[model samples]
Target: MLLGDVAHLRTGDKGDISQISVIAYDPADFPLIAREVTVARVLRHLSGVAVRAATRHELPDLGALNFVLEGALNGGVTRSLALDAHGKALGAQLLDLPLDGDAES
Candidate 1:
């Protein structure tokens, strides 16, 4: 699932953090796919901002994982989201970043 869906997003202090409950596919599915989807959604919604790290956790009995997306925002500021005449964020300027290997999806 995308970070924009069913996730609580927080920005400030250290970085941008997103917490999501684990889905039905998480436990049996490949962790990479889930991580990739989560990361991509987070980065994309925030406009391709790189994350310092994302940690996943499985709750005791609830069977959910909380994902934390760190350092993906401009230190929680509005300046990075402002567009000059055009609709865009500063992170949008980095759209040309090349993707390598198997993470192209």
Candidate 2:
């Protein structure tokens, strides 16, 4: 599936509950980039962890993508992991995305 294809994901919140937020980003695909940082694919690549995900919207004008994820922090990776060590959560998520044109260098 294309990175932009993911729209929504469901995961634990507090007591088997989950929270969902629409991915946000700059018109320059900042949201897409941010979501990628937390994308399930990247998590799997880095530590073999799986995250739930879904696409929310595509801002073609700005060339950005928005996705919802489940239990983004279910793993200790969210708490015990350092930003540098775990990657900027968002950046780590985008590791496998095929973004083109005006990519945030």
Candidate 3:
């Protein structure tokens, strides 16, 4: 199953860093999201964009996972030549990440 099937995504950016928040629709599915959406997986998923590092911050109370990705903006919005230098579309891209088949609907 795809993460998008169970969750939604939000994104923000600062300098060369991109922040992505994945929030589960059902609170019960938070555990599966947290377990599957790790820093390693995120970095690997966005590797083509030159993401240098990633950090995952769990927000259990909100049933969300926030990822801080460094060097993701190709030197930030003003410096990057990429069409979406702010990385707004990155969140949508990440929604395609595959999750365990057991992921709840």
Candidate 4:
């Protein structure tokens, strides 16, 4: 299953950093997201982008996970030549991340 099947994403960027938030559709699904969506996994998933490092912040109360990715924007909107330098599309890409099939419905 894809992460988008159980959650939605929001994205933001500043300079060379990209921030993405994944919010579970059901609170019960938060645990699965938290367990599977680690920093390592995110970095691996977005390897095409020049992500130097990543950090995952769990927001259990909000049933969400926030990831901060460094060097993802290629140098931010004003600096990068990339079309989507702001990284708005990155969130949608992340939604495509595959989740474990054993996840509870």
Candidate 1 per-residue lDDT, tens place, 1-105, comes to: 332232222222332443434343334333433444444543454454556776655553443445555654544444346223111232233232232223343
Q: Give TM per candidate.
A: 0.38, 0.34, 0.91, 0.91
lDDT tens digits, residue span 27-50, model 2: 444555555534443444435333
lDDT for model 1, on a 0 to 1 scale? Answer: 0.40
- Candidate achieving higher TM-score, 1 or 3: 3
RMSD of 2: 8.8
User: What is the RMSD, in Å, between candidate 4 and the native fold over all Cα?
Assistant: 3.1
lDDT of 2: 0.40
- TM-score attained by model 3: 0.91
Model 4's TM-score against the true structure: 0.91
* Candidate numbers sorted by TM-score from highest down: 4, 3, 1, 2
lDDT of 3 at 68: 91
lDDT of 4: 0.86
**Clashing residue pairs in candidate 1 (N, C-alpha, C atoms within 3 angstroms):** none
lDDT of each: 0.40, 0.40, 0.86, 0.86
Estimate, for each residue in 10-96, the C-alpha lDDT of model 3 and write its tens digit.
889989999999999999999999998888777777768888888889999999999998999999988999998675788988888
Least accurate 10 contiguous residues by lDDT in model 2: 8-17
